[model samples]
Target: MIPVKISEEAIKEVRNIMENKNIPDGYGLRVGVRGGGGCSAAGMNYILGFDKPKNTDKTFEVDGIPVYIDKGHVMYVIGMEVRFHNGNDAKGFVFVNPEIEKELN
Candidate 1:
């Protein structure tokens, strides 16, 4: 089973961007954690970008969209859903991770 779920809208948007940008094959959307170092304790955050899977990356396909996630970040991203928001407050991809939300609450 796929580790994460990607919304159809999000997939469409990503595909459109990929076509417009002329991104080549072998490149996929990468979902990984960043920012755990430095003096300030801001904590880890998610990042999304077009990149090639690294040796330690785990790949998943959602609606034909290739997604690469670092092996170490699999736990944090598991069961998460990526959705596209066009609402007034936000107009981009949003990650819905129940586990993290519960922890934050």
Candidate 2:
């Protein structure tokens, strides 16, 4: 099973994007880690985008949305929750990972 989860709000937003953003057919949500330490509270940054799977990827479905995660990145990203935040100040998907926090502690 995928060790991560996507919030209802995030899933809704993804659906909205899929309909209005014209994401290419066969593309799926890609979740992985970025190497830049400064980009997130955790040393590794989070990656979320739409792309096709490659040989090195592990694929799954979350709420009917296809998801792809590079096999190498799975360890660093486990137990994460993907959420959408919309407020007066900002709006976008926000990643919350207690697993990383436990490690950092």
Candidate 3:
């Protein structure tokens, strides 16, 4: 199983978004890496309301919320935690990844 972590605030935010947007059941978050933009190496991206698991993904469930991580990006995402941040400039889920710098450079 893929390693997964989710904060209480993140859970509340996700649930609120889902309810506000009228997203259907089974919708969850998909977090993974994509090879374009920002840094030369893989950068993280996420789909907030995802319905089905991608063919190349490994799944993890935390606090009744499903999170999908792509197989190719697994090594770069291990031990990462999902945090809810409400800073002055940005407000959303932030990925606390130990392998982020390694993946970037």
Candidate 4:
């Protein structure tokens, strides 16, 4: 099984969004790889509040929240950690995958 990590803040944010939007069950963040905007390589994409994930998607639970990742992205995403940063300069969820950088460089 692929391992995924999610920060506490991100969990809180997702729960808050779910509560505020009154979204029913089955809504979660989806991450996947797509053709990189006409580039020859693929890139990552993230979608929040998605109902149905693609058939080729794999599901992982992080901090009691469900996150979906496309099968094509699994190899690249394994061992990756999702973190939420909230500072005066920046505030958001960030993906940290060192293997990807090493591969790119």
Among these predictions, the greatest lDDT belongs to: 2
Model 1: residue 51 alpha-carbon error in angstroms: 0.4
Candidate 4 lDDT over residue span 51-91, tens digit each: 65678888877766677877876765567667778899998
lDDT of 2 by residue, 1-105 (tens): 986789999999998998899999899899989896554546788989999989999999988899999998888778889999999999999888766668899
Off by over 4 Å in 3: 36-49, 98-105
Per-residue lDDT for 28-58 in model 1, tens only?
9998778776543246677888998799998
TM per prediction? 0.79, 0.86, 0.69, 0.68
* TM-score of candidate 1 against the unseen true structure: 0.79
lDDT of 3 by residue, 5-33 (tens): 67789888887887788777766777766
Report lDDT per candidate.
0.82, 0.88, 0.70, 0.68
Weakest 10 consecutive residues of candidate 1 by summed lDDT: 37-46
Clashing pairs in 2: none
Residue 76 of model 2, lDDT score:
70
User: Which runs of model 1 end up more than 4 angstroms from their true locations?
Assistant: 37-42, 99-105
Estimate the lDDT of model 2. 0.88
